[model samples]
Structure formats: C-alpha cells, structure tokens
Target: MSNNHGFARIYEQGDQVNYGRSNVANEERHHTRNAEGYRPKDQNKAMNQMLEENIQDDVAERYKHDPTYRATMHGNEPSKGAKIDAEIQREEEELLRRKQEKTDSLPGKKQ
Candidate 1:
C-alpha cells in the first residue's frame, strides 16, 4: 500500500542500504596530464606553493616560540654520549652494507 503523502514510501526505500562505489564508473581521471600526454601548466601551483610557504613559516614561528611543545615531541633530548653511540652504529651499519653489497661499485671510494 502506497501513502498519498509519499513519506512512508521514502522511509521504505531508505531501509535498503545502497552501499559504496559498486555502481560508480570503473575509470580513472588523469588530472595532471591531458589526452595529448602533455601536462598543462597549472595556474594554481604558484598560489598553492605560496600558501604552503605561509603555513611552514607559521609552524616555524610557533616552534621557535613554543619550547614546551618542542620538548613534548622530542621527549627530552638524548645525551651527547647516546647521540655519539647512535651515530657510530648508523655509520657502522652503512659501512657494513656498502662492503657487503655486490651491485654497488664504490671503486676508489672504498676504505
């Protein structure tokens, strides 16, 4: 039975869930490149870059002023001994990898 006002019909239809992307067109759009396989110069690039620069400038300004926030992220800076140990381990690992790698030809750069 259908209601004359169509409110019941709308509620009945809404009960059946129409799930995600199953009905969408199976195609991708190349926003950057045109059909001619050439990238058209984006007018928004400069504007976006300037906005990003402004955001970075704001972040740096905040970071410079907010010592507590900086300390919270890093959680108490490591001691000089710990820093030196970490650096030595990293350099040792890098040297070992270079020496072991067969593909990478260091030639005269090898120690």
Candidate 2:
C-alpha cells in the first residue's frame, strides 16, 4: 500500500532549485559616462570658419530672390513697419530697465 500525503516531494532532482540563477537571464550593465576631449586651437579656428561659410551659404540661398530681403538689405522698412518697429523698441527698452532694476536689487549688486 502506498501512503500519499497529496503533496509532491520537496527534493527530487528534476525539481531542485538553484538560488540566484536563471537559464534564460541576461546580465548587462547598461549605464556609462564618457568625456569629449578638447580640440587644438588651430582646429577650433578652422571649424569656426567652416561653420560661418555654411551659414553664409544658407542665407544667400534663402534670400536670393526675396523682394523684402532686397528692400531691407538696402535701408529702412516702409512707414507702417517703421511705426511698429518704434513701438517694439520702446517695449524692449522698458523690459530692459525692469530687468536691470531686479538685478541691481540682488545681494551683491548696487542699484
């Protein structure tokens, strides 16, 4: 006669447990930090020149046939535009004064 407790045995080889081990697990450390080194002075100057050349080329391409560009490149905007410009400049000056006052009131700054 077999005595069954209706529970499976704890330590059969097929049911053995390996702690902290997984058959399909991947171990990867996914974080890193890296530094970009400085460029030599001559190379830095050459890079700046190349960037300026590209910017000039792009501007020339964009304004090649634009009438507003032709008009403004020579002198002032039309009368209505000039009035709008004056209002914008006034607002800009008011903002600049407020910013200056705020900074002047800070701890080390003098008003």
Candidate 3:
C-alpha cells in the first residue's frame, strides 16, 4: 500500500488546488452570507420568538378566563408576585448549591 499524505489522490501530480472557487452554488452562497453590517440570523431567535408569542397568548387567554389569575397578574400585584417568584427561585438555587457542595465534599468524589 502507498503511504498517503493528507492531500487527495484524485488530483494529478502538478494539479493546483483552486482556493478562489468555493464550489458552493450562488444560491447557497447568498443563503450563507449575512447582510453587510448586520448580524447573522440566529436559529434560536425564531424558536424563542415563537415560544414568547405562545406564552403571551396563553397568559392573555388566562387573564381573560380566570378572575383570580387575572387579578394576581395585573399591575401592582404582578410586581409583588414577580418579587416573590424571584426570591423563591433564589432560595431554590441556594439549596441546590448547598446540596452540590455537600455532594462534592463527600469521599470518592472529585472536586
């Protein structure tokens, strides 16, 4: 068997690799290039926008149908509710961190 370098054997001995021609079709090239001065379209952005719209629709429907939920979610109450939710989330995260620390301190576990 012949010892092969990283180069493709299909090319003749003196054939030059054409760096200029990407071989990507014009249509594909257009799709790959983002517009000048603009960021590339994020795959996750579309999904996130759809998710946000769905969540907003769900929340609006709930506000229309449920008196208690609507009352709690409105202006001043929402702020209070958000504060409580944030506090609860922080406490839960702290508890999780403590548990992780305890587990990490255990014998036979690598830190």
Best by TM-score: 3
Badly placed stretches (over 4 Å) of model 2 are 1-39, 78-111
Native-vs-model 1 lDDT? Answer: 0.45
Better of 1 and 3 by lDDT: 3
The lDDT per prediction is 0.45, 0.45, 0.50
What lDDT score is found at residue 78 in candidate 3?
53
Residues 1-111 of candidate 1 have per-residue lDDT tens digits of 444532232234445222123211111131322222212222223223334455677778856644444544578875666556667767888989877785456576555
* lDDT, model 3, position 73: 63
Error of 1 at 48 (Å): 1.1
Where in model 3 is the C-alpha error above 4 Å?
A: 1-78
Measured on C-alpha atoms, candidate 2 has an lDDT of: 0.45
Candidate 3 similarity to native, TM-score: 0.31
lDDT of 2 by residue, 1-111 (tens): 443432132224444222121211211111121111223433333333444555677678746534345446668563666556657767888999999888888997654
State the displacement of the C-alpha of residue 39, model 1, in Å, after optimal TM-score superposition.
12
In candidate 3, what are the lDDT values of residues 17-105, reduced to their tens digit? 33222322322343443222232233223233334455788898876644456656654455566556657767888999999999999
Candidate 1's TM-score reads: 0.27
